[model samples]
Target: MTSTDAFNTQGNATAVTDPHTGETRYNRVPQVTWDFWLVKLLAVTVGETAADLINTSLGLGLTNTSLLMSVFLIVALVFQFAQKRYVPVYYWTTVVLVSVVGTLITDNFIDNLGWSFTPVTLSFTAALAATFAVWYMVEKTLSIHSIYTFRREAFYWLAILFTFALGTSAGDQLAEGLGVGFLMSGLMYAAVIAVIAGLFYGGLMNGILAFWLAYIITRPMGASFGDYLSQPVANGGLGLGTIVTSLIFFAAIGATVWYMTRSKDGLEVAQD
Candidate 1:
């Protein structure tokens, strides 16, 4: 049977037929919009600051913090998958946890294993590319609009994790390892993302390509901004401290999620 036939047979909660591909999908992820990008950026920023807070300020150490956060991430993913539908709270919660865990994973390689930044970034990039290759080969599409099946969702989260790790490593390499400073690095990423957006709006790029490009760039951009706000003045930051930065972004994310939960405008709808 066809994809549409399979979706119809499954009787999903919100199946709709894709006009372009003639495929039916359940719309298990949120629609890509301004709000979606805003919350995502906040979540990554919190991820960087919060990881530093727990590992350094709280004195948990990198190993201990990674262990603790990894456990929580697993638990969050369990609840997320259990929902079998896009729940704003659970979905964003998972994203936040994954972001933190991804940062910690990269940190472990550098601090514990003594791996350098370039190798870590390259490794994660390769991993993410492989994931996309396999996902496309298996599911025939990498568009977020088709994230209706459990397998697709699994691939989606895995790719997200790699993006976070890759972003962390690349951002740190440029900002700290290369001495570009956090603010400058953030500006660089922002410019690149802006160019990508311009291309999309000008009808020179595909929507899926634009979406993934922005998605990957946002990770480092958020991390750079987070470090700039939270690090000490000696370290080129604003000296706001991790506690304040994390709390501010947490509130922002919470407010956005609350609005998304109440508004159909933020919810995912299958393409007609």
Candidate 2:
């Protein structure tokens, strides 16, 4: 039931029926394009900040925060897995939930469990590498363009979880441990992402490599940006507060997803 299979089955179905009727199937993945990244960035950014808002702004604490977000992630993932075709609401909900839950995983390990950021960061990096290793071994390909089966979706979500944890730890190390300010940390990560993009666009790097590198880097970059806007001015932030930042980002994401759904503008259905 991987995205790849879902797409093939749905694409081949002539007259698909809804779930209640047990009719036909439909394609999954939207067409890969610039819009995909735009929405992705928005979703990830919300994930970065929303988690903080729930855990800190609402005073839920790490334990409660993780538990709540984990529940939401599980529910969102269920809907995502149930769908035969790509649905923006389900897809983005899962993404946002994963982002929050992933951040909490890293936070729990680092803050609640007394693990150092260095070890947490390295561990998540290794985990991501291992996931990729296994994914490549089984699938022989890591391209997002062909995610038509459930197995690929499993691999994809596992990799995503690692990215969020890695990003959280890395961002914390840079901003708090290394004494780098929020804005500076964001700029630093942004520069690195820019280099990856340049290498990819200039033909110096492969598409998958560039994509993964950028994907990993965006976590810290977005986290840094989130902290910069949400933290108090005394802490070198604009002091917008997590509530305002989270609300604004969520609204923007909702509007964007709504538009994308209606227009099918960012549809990335796999094709021959």
Candidate 3:
């Protein structure tokens, strides 16, 4: 190439561009450790309780609540994608928003559209599996620790979105549809998670396997907990109202995120 052409290309590279300008532009994932899972569980719980609170307690109803929350999620996701690196606050905010969106997506399918939980659950599961298949094909890995590129980040969020959707459907099926109620369903999933944890700590299972299993189970567990608090007393819940439950969880999430930001506990090298 000519010297002038080379100089022009270098100038373009040095010019200020977008919101992502620093080292944070490159890393897309936080290290997968105990804190990661803990915060994740909190986010899912908040997602369930917060969504229910808005829809019921605030008298927004499912349809309106979904619309409002969906819009917020879109905004949050836009900001999240604009970031070049992993900011704990921004990342977790996106997670919490997506959790609510995921819940609404399933709720719309089952409640508004009059679809059955069985079909919805299976459909979302298939979709998530297909996402993983394609993501693995394109990225050659599904491990969260290695999510450093744009493509991997895309796959990561897509998978998370499906997990929330599938979890909502499954949780609803086992609780209300099957007449299992909220408490029992929560306990059941909690027990299963405990077993997975034991296996992982005992070295009888793989870390990634345990992580993914727990990740999937945490959704139903959180959903059941949310239902137990927000559902009416006649429905075997505390009648606390969805708004109260959601507020409580949202506050908790906010505090946790604040602590994480100051502590920088979950932000580090994600390499295994």
Model 2 — TM-score against the truth? Answer: 0.87
- CA lDDT of 65 in candidate 2? 88
Better of 1 and 2 by lDDT: 1
Between prediction 1 and prediction 3, the one with superior TM-score is 1
Model 2 over residues 1-272: C-alpha lDDT tens digits? Answer: 22232211123323334458765444465644555666666677788788888887789888998998899899988888887678888888887888888888988998899999899999999999999999989987776655657898789889988988888888788778768798998899889978876776676877667777777788888778887888899999999988888888888889888987898764554432
TM-score of 1: 0.89
TM-score, one value per model: 0.89, 0.87, 0.84
Best first by lDDT, ranked: 1, 2, 3
Model 3 per-residue lDDT at 175: 70
- lDDT agreement with native, every candidate: 0.84, 0.77, 0.76
Error of 1 at 99 (Å): 0.6
| Cα RMSD to the true fold for all candidates | 6.4, 5.7, 10.0
lDDT of 1 by residue, 1-272 (tens): 22221112112334466568976545667777677888989999999999999999999999999999999999999998876457899999999999999999999999999999989999999999999999999987777766766898899999999989988898788777667888988899999988987886676877667777778888889998999999999999999999999999999999999998887544555532
Error of 3 at 170 (Å): 1.0
Model 1 residue runs over 4 Å out of place are: 1-25
Candidate achieving higher TM-score, 1 or 2: 1
